[model samples]
Target: MFKLLFLVLLAASVHQARPDGRIVNGETANSMAVAPWQVSLQTSYHFCGGSLISPTHVMTAAHCYQRFGVTVHFGSVSNANSPNVFDVSTFTQHPSYSTGITTDYDYAVIKMAQSASMNSNTQDIALPDDTDYTGQTAQISGWGQLSGSGGTPTLLQVATVPIVSEDACKSQWGNLRITDRMICAGGAGTSACMGDSGGPLAIKDSSGKWVLLGNTSWGSSSCTTNTVSVWSKNANQLSWINGQMNS
Candidate 1:
C-alpha cells in the first residue's frame, strides 16, 4: 500500500500489507553491503526507511513516528530477515511537525534500546556541513514499490537523483510551500515513493565521503517521471539534531 497515489497533494503513503517498492531505473537488486548506514524501521502497523546517524541514534521523518512499538532493523537488505533488530529506547520528533500540510519540518530522532555494534556491516553516516547543495548529485535508497501498481521489493533499492534549486522545485510544486528546510530532487521517472519515506538523501563530498543531506519526506502520488520528490533538509536542522542527540 506504499506510494499508490496519483495526485500531487496526497504525497506517497506506502504503509500497508506491503511497505514500498524498488527504486526507479535502479538495480534489479542491491545489497546493504554498499549502504551500511541505511536502516529499516518497523512500526506496529507498517514499515518506513531510516538512516544510522550514530551507534545509538537513527534519523527519520517525524511523521513516520506515528504510534509506539517501533523497532530498527540493521545490517540487511531484505525486509523479511533483518539480521539485527534493536528496540527503540526513546524517540523525539520536531516540535512543529504536522501532517496534511507542508512537510518542511518533518524530522525525527530515535535512540536505540542499546548501542548498535559498530562494524563493516553497520556504521553511521556523516552529516553534512552548512554548505549549499542545490546542484549536487545525491543517492536515495529504499524498499518502496517500483510503480504505483507494483509490489515492494525484497532487496533494498537505490537511485541517483540530482538536487534541484528551490526556485525550480517551487515552480513544479506550485503553492506546496517549498521552504529552505526542504530539498527537492528527482523528477518525472525518478523519485522516492511511499515506503521510501524517512530515508536518507545522501551526497558524496569532495573527499569522497558520503554526507547525509536530506530525509525522504514526500513526493508525487503517481511516482511519475515528471514529479519532483521533496526531502527534509538535514543541514538546516543540524543544530536541532545535535541538541536532541546530545540531550
Candidate 2:
C-alpha cells in the first residue's frame, strides 16, 4: 500500500487511520486566523500539508505528491472547509526521491493550474539563507493528529521546537542515515506526528520574517515516543528549488 512518507499509526488503530502526522506534546491551536502561506494537499482520499513559496509554487515533501490526482487548498485552516482550491497542473520531486528506501532529498514543488491570488489570508513565505539554524527556535504547523487513536483536527495546529544539532541527531538515530540534507527537531515527546509530513518547518529570522528552513519528512514510529523528527533541509535545496522555478 502507498503510504504518506512519515505516518505510523498505532498498531491497534491501523485500519482506521489515515496516513498522516501531527504536532504532539507542545502543540496549540493556532489562535490567529491566517497562516498566509500554509496550504493543504488533498488527494483522492487523503491529505497532507504544504507551504506556498510563490504564487504558482507550493513546496512539499516528494512523498505527498500523488501522480493520480492532487488539489491544493489555501486560505483556510480547516482542511475540510478550505475555500480556495486549485488543481495542480504539474509537480517535480527531488531527483533522488525513492519510496520506502530513503528519506533523503524528499522535497518537491507543485505548480498550480492557476496562480493564487495574494490576499490577507494568502501569501508566500520567504526561503532561508545559508545561515545554519542549529539551536534556533522554529515553528511547525499542520492539521495532523493529536494522538495515535485521535483523528486529525479540523483546526490547524502549531508547535515550537528548537533545531537539533546534526551530531546529536546522528547519535540518536544510530544506524539510520542522517545526512546533512536533513534537519532534526523535536524530541522528548514533542514532535511532528502523522499528517504533518510535507508541511514547512520554519524559523523567524532576525528581521522577524518567517523563513522556511525545512519541511516535515519522517520521524519515530509513534507520536508519543521520544524521538527526533527529521525534516528535509530547505536551505540545502534552495538552488534546486530556484532552478526549477526559473527553468
Candidates in order have lDDT scores of 0.74, 0.74
Cα lDDT of model 1 overall? Answer: 0.74
> On a 0 to 100 scale, what is the lDDT of residue 216 in model 1?
81
- Count residue pairs with overlapping backbones in model 2: 8
For each candidate in turn, the TM-score is 0.88, 0.87
- Tens digits of per-residue lDDT, candidate 1, 1-247, equal 1231222343333311111323565554356757788888876423688899999999988767755788898888786688898999888999977554465587899988888888777889998887777777788887777776577776788788888888888777654557878888877357677677788888888889988897887765656656677788999989999887888
Q: Which regions of candidate 1 are displaced past 4 Å?
A: 1-22, 44-46
| Clash-forming residue pairs, model 1 | 2-14, 20-144, 20-145, 21-144, 21-145, 188-224, 188-225, 188-226, 188-227, 189-225
Q: Which stretches of candidate 2 lie over 4 Å from their true place?
A: 1-20, 26-34, 99-101
Please provide, for model 2 over 1-247, each residue's C-alpha lDDT reduced to its tens digit, 9 standing for 90 to 100. Answer: 0124543332322222122467775454454234678888888533778899999999988877689679998887677788888999888899987543346788899988889888877889988987887887888888777765567777778778788899988776643456868888877556777777788888888889888888887765556445667788988889999987776
- Compared to the true structure, candidate 2 yields what TM-score? 0.87
